[model samples]
Target: MGSNDSEYFSDEEEAWVMYKDRSEWADITPLPQNDGPNPVVRIAYSDTFTDVYDYFRAVVAKGELSERALQLTEDALHMNTANYTVWQYRRKCLAHLGSDLEKELVFCREMIELNPKNYQVWHHRRVIVEWNGHADKELRLTEIIFSQDAKNYHAWEHRQWVLRTYRLYDGELEYVNRLLEEDVRNNSAWNQRYFVIVQTTGYTQDVIKQEVEYTKKAIEKVVNNESPWSYLRGVLQHSEKGLHSVEGLESWCMALHEAGNNSPFLMAFLIDLAEDTMECHIEEREEKLAKVLEWCESLATEHDKIRREFWRYMARHISHKYSV
Candidate 1:
């Protein structure tokens, strides 16, 4: 919006008022919105909103792309930020007028601060950044947003786009580590770690080894935590090397199981490993089926009784599949 422009301010006072009172808009006739006959529910629009939108319609109908038109869009947006049509018009004005995209970025940052989850505002910011090619501040903006709400999906998505588009992967791992340290249960951070790894260095052997060790430490810290276990499984899957490739994973799970840790995720992981083993080693199909049945029975009768029927069904299916 224009800063302290006399056209927006009343002559006698300093307050911004309706566009009808502005001398600059006097030449254009305001076009009021038609509600059609017998509206279902008439919106009780304030006079200011009614007047602003009336002038907005006039300007849009005329297809005006001037400074005043830009300011008018800003006014409409301030009242209703979610109005995607207003945002689109504003972008057109910005491009037609060759407005300073840097200032536009600042405006978008302010909008994000007010409502980080606003989809249109984020899309506008992305478009501006794409045009300006200045994504240096995007990371910090997303970090600030994440600090406020770590699980904000929009912020995470925006950060990923910025990072991937700008190749800003230098400190992303450390950033993810910091977030994970702050809250180990933050599944978003765990997923972000996977994304950063896959996008940048990929799941190389050394990277897989580091991730496996990382997941082990994380799971050891909290036996019942599901995030790290899921990450571990994802890492193994991406490696395409199967469970045996991890060397100590199966034994580690067995050790945890022997120590009386009956976490459902742990059991699920073991079941998956056993199923994989059954496919790879036909000789051990009977033995693996027995182990699977034991665990499924244990889960149905003891640990995860709420899913008893599901587990029982699994037991039946596994037994029938292998003729155990």
Candidate 2:
């Protein structure tokens, strides 16, 4: 087969037949081709993928752009939902045949439910949504998917893309708050919270202070959890110059340290906050800075054994930065 493959918007197909109870043999039927500028299929593959590939390979090569091609693409997509070629060809048909954008969205929604993890399925939906221009349902879809599986990276990524693309930030923070209420350890939820803050206010002093109070309570609820600690640092970064000082973070860290929680991230962030204080010309208490630096050395050499090298590097960087 030649390789005049789907090049534009190209990326990275299957079908099935049962033979005997033993080894399965694949169907190798050749697909129909239209007499047009291109009249041949040019994809190469084997096994369960050949039938759908063969058909779509020809449908696309022949530059078919009618309702027939659209129907065939729908069939081919059922066999291999992630085939970008089928998706691209389908888009062309949608345009050339004047297909309804809402109907296309419904088709893509079905595909997404059937193949949630398939990047092509989600990507195709994004293309359709970009055209359809009503992302309210898309946002709800992401939220629904995340509610069922909070850690689904694909769903979370799509959610982030949808919100950013549509500027649908209203209620986004509250949604994450509800999610965190269910599970504060959900780092994705925390990241979403941070994403919303940065988009809304660049984490102004008031916003940062509010988030600090929020996360302080969150971290207090779970001593060794890292989500609150990480989000606190992220929000602090956007606070006004010298305005992001670790207000209650030190007292919390001291309590955690005294309780032998000894969380590596807590200790690491504690030292980082100490450095941030020095940089901001806040009254740098040498004792406070020295205490966290010593904790960093201890964590690097003893406690945080898994990330020993990372903490060691942090220690060196801090020493060099402050001549400690």
Candidate 3:
């Protein structure tokens, strides 16, 4: 059987076939669902790299854009999905060939499974969704991709575009909450939460007030994690209140600092709060701001040596703490 198999596969496509229990979707298309040593591509074709490459060149040479041109491009992409030119040409062919875009979405999703970070595949997938106008399906597919890699910029960008284009911001905050519950250190999740909040509610004080309570819970969860602290600063910075204007904010930082956290971010946040509360040239609250900044400088310099330069830079640049 092995010797006879050589007759069907091209030199580049030669591989062993191991039968396994296939899914109901197996007939849908040939994209491998499992990975193993020497995993062969599921797209069984006798087309060789040389043959596909030659045909692609011939089509481009003739400027012939048709459905027949897709076969050679697909074969080439099967070997190297990163080829931008091939993907661009394929898009042109796809549009002119009257090809089935629904099937193309399936193919693109399968390719994404092989390498989620492949730019061309994602670009092509985005183009198809935009052209076909399946906002709901695009949202669902992007959510699945985000579940696989929460911090994937491309996936997040696509999700944002889908939500904005379709006005689908209803459940995004809840989705972000789920992500945060899974890992509080997920900065991307925190960022997404902020995005959703802004998209739905804008920067109104009520929204900021609600977000502040939510953010404080996260900040106090792990005083050392910088992501939530950054999120807290970002949302609050856009609010009507200054950073330090939040009730008991200073004492909370003091409590966290005294909890033996040695967290540069908490200290840094407190330092910003103190500086923001001061008038630049009025000298009011200068004593309080100076003391807070000096304390943060000393703490960061001693315990967080990694960011000591940053603390030093803050001290050198900030004049709010100094008396006028």
Instruction: Give per-residue CA lDDT, model 2, range 171-201, as digits (tens).
Output: 8888988999999899999988888877777
TM-score of each: 0.91, 0.78, 0.80
lDDT of 3 at 306: 80
Cα lDDT computed for each candidate against the true fold = 0.88, 0.72, 0.72
Candidate 1 vs 3: which has more TM-score:
1
Clash totals for all candidate models: 0, 0, 0
Residue 223's lDDT in candidate 2: 63
Output the TM-score of candidate 3: 0.80
The regions of model 1 sitting more than 4 angstroms off are: 1-14
For model 2, the local distance difference test gives 0.72
RMSD (Å) of each candidate, 1 decimal: 4.1, 8.1, 9.2
Ranking by TM-score: 1, 3, 2
Best by lDDT: 1
On lDDT, the stronger of 1 and 2 is: 1
- Candidate 3, superposed: residue stretches over 4 Å from native: 1-47, 280-286, 319-321
